[model samples]
Target: MTTGGIARQVVLRAAATAAGPALLLRRWTTADADALVEAYRDPVLRAWTRLGVPDAGAAVRWVEAQRTGWEGGGRLSFAVVEEEPGGGRVAGNVVLKRPEPAGPAGEVGYWTAAHARGRGVAPRALQVLTDWVFETFAGQGLEYLELMHQVDNTASCRVAEKAGYGFERVLPAVPPFPRDGHLHLRWATGGPVPG
Candidate 1:
């Protein structure tokens, strides 16, 4: 399979969490299907997310497929959960998926729930995910990391900037939208890679 195609197969297992401000990144499980459905079903989430699944049942099946990919060695998909302020369930979720090839680098895609907006969740989760990706996959010839957000997603742009991703370019009329015109902001981290 192609690198990107292979990446789609890999499922990222959960990472350990320690005390003092932690961002728990883990692989999706059957247990999380409900949470995934609930989060993705939100209208705001539906707007920005690129998920292809049509319903909750499909979401569950998708997670299962990702698990199979995890067992293989293709892609990494993670769920971001933060500890509550006082003590309870995690606030919500932030997700990062590793794209294949990424042309000498890795591409990251992320999203945060409506309830978790403006809480710094995306930035924190992004930092952890990016650091881990670079460290663990350095041997894979990765030189940079890339992220993209719709022109209208100011909040996402802020997170990318805060996380140290520099603006690289803008693609006009890509990923066309029905109403708003197409415009995408591309951001990069680390540095340029040799061809």
Candidate 2:
């Protein structure tokens, strides 16, 4: 799909690591707004992200925000889709945010659709995004990526670990995040996954 404001669509693919199917990661198009709005309908997703995407309009705005981030040269996001003979479908979303144009650190976040859960979509999509950020932003300056999720979000904990993000610390509840969070880190090198 064509990405708004994105000069070149960066598609990241990872082959089936096991029984899970191969997956494709690409920019979220306006067409995916409906899927995103539907995804936010899931209570599980809403509670975690604390997002108020109650309709298509909000989803469109959200998609536009991602595009703005892309055009600004930071905060990359993707619509994780599973490739199939029939075609690819939105499996989830993965974002690598806060990589300042001249900074050394960034953050990673992702969520799997209700239908795509338990198939290793979160971690796989995360791995693909992680790899692309560190490589594609070569001169922009990147040394590490952090992932923070509520301590009770065991699924995210698993995704982080599976994606090779080492448990860094426990973060106190702050504003939007009501519960303590687990901060996971994956360094550019000399850490888990080794750059």
Candidate 3:
């Protein structure tokens, strides 16, 4: 598989004015550490995603880890930033990791920032990421994507549904987490996966 050139230029569609500016899925940078630290401080985010950046230093480490993961293969991480005047805010993150290089599947994970929640950000960001991945990596052998969330996370389930991921089944005894979770699947369409 072509690892180095995985996501050279995968920009998603520009959002309509009524919705918002086009969502940009770019690689995380050190400048985003502060926002990431603040985003992880959200109680709801910590409770659900269990990710906590804690401080700017740790946030920088987290961002660096994501970059290393991309460089090492098997992972692709993007900051979900909304387009606005004078740059944009770090709204959230969407990541595809644990890729099966020789297989046709990968896992996706995401979380919306506290201030960005409830504005259709997560679902729309996920939709764009999913579409970009399937289209850009099709020739590299990617075929399907999988998303799993705590069964009790109704909001995440809704996001998966809105992003066109079909409910597959409940995966039991998932390691690192005790509770059973719902498994959602979205296969790559010839074009963008319809949401």
Compare the candidates by TM-score and give the number of the best one: 2
Model 3's TM-score against the true structure: 0.89
lDDT of 2: 0.85
lDDT by residue for model 3 (1-195), tens: 344666544455437345566677788889999899899888899888755799998998999898887887678888988888898888889988855666778889899898888787888888888877777677877778899998988999999998989999998866677688999998886334566
Worst 10 residues of 3 by lDDT: 8-17
What lDDT is obtained when candidate 3 is compared to the true structure? 0.82
Candidate 3 stretches greater than 4 Å from native = 1-3, 7-14, 17-19, 190-195
- Higher-scoring candidate on TM-score, 1 or 3: 3
TM-score of each: 0.72, 0.90, 0.89
Q: Which stretches of candidate 1 lie over 4 Å from their true place?
A: 1-21, 52-55, 84-103, 175-189, 193-195
Give the Cα-based TM-score of candidate 2 against the true structure: 0.90
Return the lDDT, model 1, position 70. Answer: 56
Ranking of models by TM-score: 2, 3, 1
Query: Tens digit of lDDT per residue, candidate 2, span 86-185?
Result: 9878889999777455688899899988888999999888988888877866666677888999999999999999999999999999997789999999
Give the Å shift of residue 66 in candidate 3. 0.7
